[model samples]
Target: MSSYLYRLGRSSAAHPWRVISAWILLVATAAALASSFGAPMRDDWDVPGARAQQGIDLLREHGVGGFASARVVVHDREGDPLPSAEIGTLTERLRGLEHVADVGPARLSGDRDTAVLTVQYAEPITHPDLMGNIEPLGGAISGTVDSGLQVELGGEVPDTAGEAFGGTGELVGVGIALLILVIALGSAVGAGLPIAAAVAGLAAGSSGIALLAATMTVSTSAPMVASMVGLGVGIDYALLLVTRHVEHLRLGHDAVESAGRAVATSGRSVVFAAVTVLVSLMGLRLAGLSTYDSFGLATAIAVVFVAAAALTLVPALCRLGGRKLLPRAVRRNRPLRTREPLTARWAARVGRKPLVWALVSLGALLVLAAPVLDLRTWPGDASSQPAGNTTRQAYDLVAAELGPGANGPLTVVVPTSATGAADEAVATLRADDRIAGLEPVVTTPDGALSIITAEPAFRPTDERTPDLIDDLRAALPASAEVTGWTPFFSDISDMLQERLWLVIAFVVGVSVLLLALMFRSVLVPLKAAAMNLLSITAAYGVLVAVFQWGWAAELIGVDQPMPISSWMPILQFAILFGLSMDYEVFLLSRIREDYLRTGDPRGSVVRGLSATGRVITSAAAIMVVVFLGFATEGDVVVKQLGLGMAVAIVLDATLVRMVLVPATMSLLGHWNWWLPGWLDRLLPTVRVEVEDEPAPERELVGV
Candidate 1:
């Protein structure tokens, strides 16, 4: 594998333009194909076999409330009753709009200051043209807004548009990454190479995601998530290869040979790291939701393209830049570092008291992870959106004028043949004090099915809302099934909670197996898994504090405390666990390389830290910056993912990698490299770093 990569790198370096042109053509072709053939991306939260889905199926079968609906809220700015003439005109306009089946009569608030016009669509929200109605719907409401009334659209139809993926976050993240690289690499050309490679790869990956949407259901947020992962990993992967190549050039190796050697070593680790990420993402399939599948597939595609670019384009660019890739001081053949690096000194100091360092770091991680014990999760609703969002404004108006429960009305579907059951269920619903209101039973014209709407006294995010769902299900007859957007989200949260453990086990187990094969060590993989879990749990705790506990919520634009998104833990575990392993692989592979040559465990630890510490921290800083930039996104789910990942990366790079890993490995001594002879014979040999190659002399610039 190493030999193949070495030859490939040398060939790419020998013909830089050829390699460069091939990448350009690939990216352009993907973009063109995506533009011509891509399907529109949308969110589909269906849980196929869940009760909520079953009820929806029943409703759709009967041609009733299964379709999408939205609320056009009109509020008088001066707290007076709205003009009836304008309200009636807006209602007629909305009914005439495309896809709008009916506009129900306007319901006034107690104060008569706010009115809600319920617009029901003929098709479901996922229909391609359903979103098309948004523009016309806006046009229909313009005259009302032109009057002295505040108008906003909310509910399933308007919420489907979600938050747009503005390029501000990506541009800011990339700009910051380039700045960090310039300072670390100390050469304009050197700094730009990785950014260029990352951007090219990200373009290809994003185009591929669009193309994927043509063939399968892709989430609206998939592109943004892919961009986030692709940019961070792509730059980090290229940076690793560039740092190694610069070290070789400083050691007097020619550019072509240096590039080959860098690919043969650091490139090997890149491949392994990327594979670990892909493998971890595969666990999302166990989540049994299409949204989860799209997240995993989208991210995996990005990683694959980014890794390929790192293996190919970075080396070619390195060769093209030649000595210009080096800092002016280094190109002048000045002396490199004359003293031990601070990382090496720190490693030694920790090695002197491994037990103490390990215990302290472990304790800190545990404290950070403590909040996860109180973590609660729910699928996000419009209420969780940014306050300025129209949906949020409508939600607030509805909750203030009507009850919070009015925002999440539950649908109960019963067969007309079970008239006795329907009557009893309606009675039960009306009797429950938790039920704020119950609508008259509406039966099909042919009397095949009956539909009942029940409003709760609490919002969807409120704990009692789900409890009411449970209580209603228990109280209603077996023939009556409860379902709606609110119930569907509740079911999704329930399903994710049930499968999260399985996802964790699958990701961790597979990663450990892969690491054991690569390093031929049992304890090493175990220790890495444990450390990764600590960092990930710490991230979860931080999420709970900020998002759920409302600690500094305004800092991230969260308006109030809400349960963490149910999908966050499983998704974060898969992505963060793999990303955490990236630093682990870079550090350990170098340590293993040194240990093979010198057989001095403690000294190898110090030497490995000295060799890879700066590059790892720099890579992590770029990742942290990139992720935190996305934390500013309008979507709360994206914000949670971004902030959680950034925090995890910081903790992993510093507390876990710099402290806990070294301390544990130092204390374990020879056991850190030990593999049972029987197990070693059974496992296939995999090398993350080339063993026979000579280590390059250390250089002062970044390496």
Candidate 2:
């Protein structure tokens, strides 16, 4: 693999124009097509094969919008009855919209101060343009409102708000990355190479996502998430190779030869790191959610492009710039290797007291991970919405006028055969203290099915809400099923929780095997896996504290603490594990190379730390900034993802990578590279830091 990459790098460097032109053409074409044909992004959380889905299908068959409808809340804020004339006009206007099929009769509160209008669309509410089709309706109604009354849209339509990423995050992330690169590389050309490669890779990846959306259901957050991952890894991946290439140039190697050597060594590490990340992301398919599938696949595609750019484009840039890549003053007086750096000294100290350092790091991780015991998962609730958002205001108004339970009422579907059971179920449901109200039962024309609305006293994010659903399910007849956003969220939460272990096992098992093959070691891969898990667990605990426990929620730019998104832990585990493994591969591979060259294990550890510590730290810093930028996004789910990833990467880079890894490897000593003869024979050799050279530069044909 290393040799192949070396040859590809040599070819690309030899024909820089062809490489640059091909990449430009590919990205430009993709961007053009994406702008014209890109599929609209939507978040459809409907779980296939669940009772909620069945109810949705049944609802659609009955000429209703099923589970998809917008609720228009009309209220009098001045303690006067709402204008019935205006309310009637508003309903008619909604009913006249292009996509609106039916508007339910306005149901006024006892005081006639609040009125609720349910606008059902003819098409599936999941249609991307549903909001656009009815946006004018909101404008028309708002124009009719006087100082005495307020009209607002809520439920599904309002829920779709804040989907736009606004490019602020990407710009901030890239800006921070560029700053870091400039500091580390000390040359504008050297720094710009990685930034250019990252931008190209992200552009291609985003175009691919837009195209993929045309045929599949994709989360609106997919593009931002993919960019977040792509830019971080793309820059870091190129940075490692660029750093190595500059070193070779300083050693007096020509442009082509230096680029080739860099690609052969650090480029191989990039490939292995990217593969590890892909493997972890692929595990998301086991999650059985469309959202997971889109996120996983989109990110995987982005990583592939970035990895390719790192291997081919970065080396080409190296050849193009040559010695000019370095600052002239620095080039004239290149720093020479004299004494060991602080990182080397730190490694030696850790090596001398491996047991103590390992215990301390592990203990700290365990303390941070302790909060996972209380982790709870649910879809974001009204409280999680941004401050001053109409959705949040509507949610508050409706809850205050009606009840908190009215925010997400559970829909109970009963088969006609169980009419008698339905009566008993209704009695049981009304008897429960959690039940706030029960709407009159509505049945199908032939009485084949019945729908009962049961409003819970607690909000959807409340823990008791899910418990109530489970309790109601058990108390109701077998033919009766619970459905609605509240119940559907519960179902999704349960499904993700069930599959979490399976996905973790698959990712960890395969990652360990892959690492073993690459390093020809058992303990090393196992140690890496364990450390990755520790870092992720610590991140999970922090998520629980910040989002779940509501600690410093305002500081995170949220209104309050909310239940962690049901799929967040699983997604974070997969992504963080792969990313954590990235640094592991880069660090361990360099350590292995030095170890092979010198029989002294301790000396090799010190040398490896000294050689790659700055680059690794810089890379992790870029990743941290990218993740944190997304963490501050307006959307709750996106914010959770950003925070979880950012926290995990910080811990992995500092605590796990800097402290635990060296400690464990130092303790393992020569045993770190041990591979049984049988296993060694079965595993193909894959070196991340190959020492072998290719044929002489003159003999290479492409040049």
Candidate 3:
């Protein structure tokens, strides 16, 4: 693999324009195709085999499936009764709009100053263009606002019309990344090389996702998630290769030769890191949700393209810039060193007191992880949206006037064949004190199914709501099933919780095996797995504190404490675990390389840290900043994911890499590289830090 990559890099560098042109053409073609034929991405929360979905499908087949409904809440600016004439006109306009099936008579509140009009859609909320229906509905209500009425649209239509992607968050991330790169590389041209490669790769990957959406149900969040991962990994990968190339240049190697050496050595690590991420993402399929599948596939595609760009485009750009890739001082042949680097000194100090450093870092991580014990998860709803959002406004209004459960009503579907059971279920629901209100039963014209709608006294996010669902399911007849948006989301949360361990097992098992194979060591892979888990759990703990516990929720625009999104644990595990392995592979490969060459366990640990610390820190900073930018996004789910990733990267790079890793390796000594004789023979040699010539000796000094 190294040999082939070396040749590929050399050829690409020798003919830089040709390589650059080829990449440009490929990206252009992909973008053109995507724009011409790709489908719009949307979230699909359906769990295929869940009972809620089964009930929904049965109702749809019987021509009695519930239609998507929206509320048009109006309030007179002056505390006076809403004019009947304006209400009549608004209803007529709503009825004439596209996808409008029915507009119910206006129901006035006790004060008569507030009125609620329900509009039902012809199709289900899962319709691909559900947001399209929302626009016209909003237009229909616009005229009423001018006539002294304050109107807000809410319910299924407006609640599902998610925020637009690619806003302030992305721009801020890119800007910060560029600044970090420039400072780290010491040359603007060199810094731009990584940025250019990353952007090109992101463009190609996004187009691929768009094309993928045409063939499958892609989640609306898929592209945003893909972008966040793609940009971070893309820049980090290119930075690794570019940093290696710069080092080769400093050693007096020519452009093409330097590019070849960089690709052969650092590019191998990039491939390994990307493979781990891809493998982890594939584990999302075990989640048994289409949303998870889209997330995995979209992110994997981005990673592949970004890694490819690093191996090819980065080298070409480095070659084209040549000596300019170096800083002005270095290019003028000035002395590059004055004293031992700080990392070398720090590494030596940690090596001397390995036990103390290890225990301290471990204790800190455990403290951060303590919050996971109280972690609560639910699928986000209108209540989780920003307070200023229309859906949230409507949610607050309905809860105030009607009931909190009005925001998420439950629908019970009963087969008409079980007439006695249907009657008994209604009686039981009416008897339950927890029930807020039960609508009259409506049966299909064909008399095949009976639809019973009931509102709960509590909000959907309330823990008791799901408990109520469980109680109903147990008490109701087998023929009666509860199905609605609220129940659907609850079922999804339940399903994800059940399958979380399976996904973690698959991802961890496969990753550990891969790491073991790559390093030809048992303890190293096991250690890496344990360290990665510590960081992941710590991230989850932070999420619980900020989002669930509402410690600093206002900073991120969250108005109230809400359960962590159910899918986040599995999603974050797969993504953060894979990403954490990135720094692990890079750091461990260099350490292993030095250990193999010198046969000095302690010296190798210090030398590896001295050699790779700057690049690792720079790469981690870029990832952290990029993710933090996305943390400011409007969508609560996106914000949580972004913040979680940023926190994980920070902890992984600082405490885990700087303290725990060196401490553990120092304590283990020669055992860090220990492989059983039989196991060593069975594992194929995979060189990540290939050397064509002898490595230079380092001046190891104590702090």
Q: Sorted on TM-score, highest at the top, how do the candidates line up?
A: 1, 3, 2
lDDT over C-alpha atoms for residue 285 of model 1 = 91
How do the residues 484-560 of candidate 1 rate in per-residue lDDT, one tens digit apiece?
98888888888888899999999999999989988889999999999999999999999999998899999888889
Show the lowest summed lDDT stretch of 10 residues, model 2.
694-703
User: Ten residues in a row with the worst lDDT in model 3?
Assistant: 694-703
Candidate 3 lDDT, tens digit per residue, 358-462?
999999999999999999889887788888888888788878877888778889988889859889899989988888999889897788888899999998888
For model 2, the superposed segments whose C-alpha errors exceed 4 Å read 32-38, 42-44, 65-67, 131-134, 146-148, 334-339, 692-703
- Deviation from native of the Cα of residue 135 in model 1, angstroms: 1.5
lDDT of 2 by residue, 12-36 (tens): 8888888888899989998899889
lDDT of each: 0.89, 0.83, 0.88
By lDDT rank, best first, the candidates go 1, 3, 2
Each prediction's RMSD to truth: 1.9, 3.4, 2.6
Looking at model 1, residue 486 earns an lDDT score of: 83
TM-score, predicted candidate 2 vs. hidden true structure: 0.95
